[model samples]
Target: MTTKTRAAEIDALLKELYPRAEIALRFESDFQLLVAVILSAQTTDVSVNKVTPVLFDRFPDARALAGADPAEVEEIVHPTGFFRNKTKNIIGAAQRIVAEYDGRVPDTMEDLLTLPGVARKTANIVLYNAFGKAEGIAVDTHVFRLAHRLGYSSEKDANKVERDLMALFPREEWGALTYRLIEHGRAICDAKRPICGQCALADLCPSAFTVNGWREQA
Candidate 1:
């Protein structure tokens, strides 16, 4: 299939399989989402969710978070792993949000990137979830793996994969597309062992049933 046709088919399959896919991070507001996203780096959503209630209770907004002690923040987020660095980034990001953005999370990618610890992925999450902007695809691990396995892109780097996906998909579907792929990856196309036989996109997936000699059946 052509790349465009493949993208469309994958898109349809993803929507059918994960119709309700949305942000997994538990947050009450944009600032909370930002902090949750930061803590989610290299950590599971379950872990982040476990710690964020107390963290958010202690520091409800950018102003409160900006004034919080780094040590206390680290202690609160310790369970998320990389607590020290995450604390620094969260506090630094909050400080920048208060100082520069008037205590509101910036919606645009460029402005969001100006905040400390705000990379393209985090910025994209905020823009898409918090502000309803669909600037480009957020190529996290799920999107990265699914894109290659579905024959959509072969780039190893997240940014390159993001770029390739942006070229392949419409701008409007970018946000939902990535979210659906993430849901699919978690539920079906797992990294270590994908449940290909039951996957809705198995027929379309280039890597589906390839492990365990199932490709021989193909």
Candidate 2:
């Protein structure tokens, strides 16, 4: 079958497997969501969630965080790893939001990109989840690996992989596709050890049960 046809099949199966897939990050507002997504870099949602409660309580919004002392922020977010850089990025982003957008998180991809530490990946998630926009796909590690394993893309770089995926999948499915692939990755398509036996896309996946597919069992 063609790439588009195969991609559609993969997406359909993923929807069946993860019928209620949504952003795992817990946040009550757009600014909170944006902060959570930024902290989520190089960290798991669980870890981000653990720290966000205290962080949000202390610095609840863009205006609040924009003036937050880095030292205090660092103490709260230290558990998420890269505490120093994450602290700086998030603070810088909040400052920009406050200074430019008047304390509101901008919805446009272009405007989001202008914020510190806000890349295409972060911008894509914020746009999709917070504002319900679909400017592009968010190609996280899971999406990158799954794209290659499923023969959707051969690009090594994330931006290139995202471009390839954008071409293959429908725009409407772009946002949810990231989370679905991530769910499948965590559930059965692990990086070091994949459980191909339980994988729904095993038959169609080019890398299924291949050299990189199996993990040593205990």
- Local lDDT at 72 for model 1: 93
Give the CA lDDT, 0 to 100, for residue 23 in model 1. 88
lDDT (CA) per prediction: 0.89, 0.90
- Show how many residue pairs clash in every candidate, following the order shown: 0, 0
The RMSD of every model to the true structure, in order and in angstroms, is 1.2, 2.5
Candidate 1, residues 1-218, lDDT tens digits: the string is: 78888789879877887889998999999999999999999989899999999999999999999999999999999999999999999999999999999999988999998887889999999999999999888888888998888888888889998999999989889888888989988998889888777777877777875755556765
State residue 78's C-alpha deviation in candidate 2, in Å.
0.4
Estimate the TM-score of every prediction: 0.96, 0.95
Model 1: how far residue 146 lies from native, Å: 0.7
Predicted structure 2: lDDT: 0.90
Worst 10 residues of 1 by lDDT: 209-218
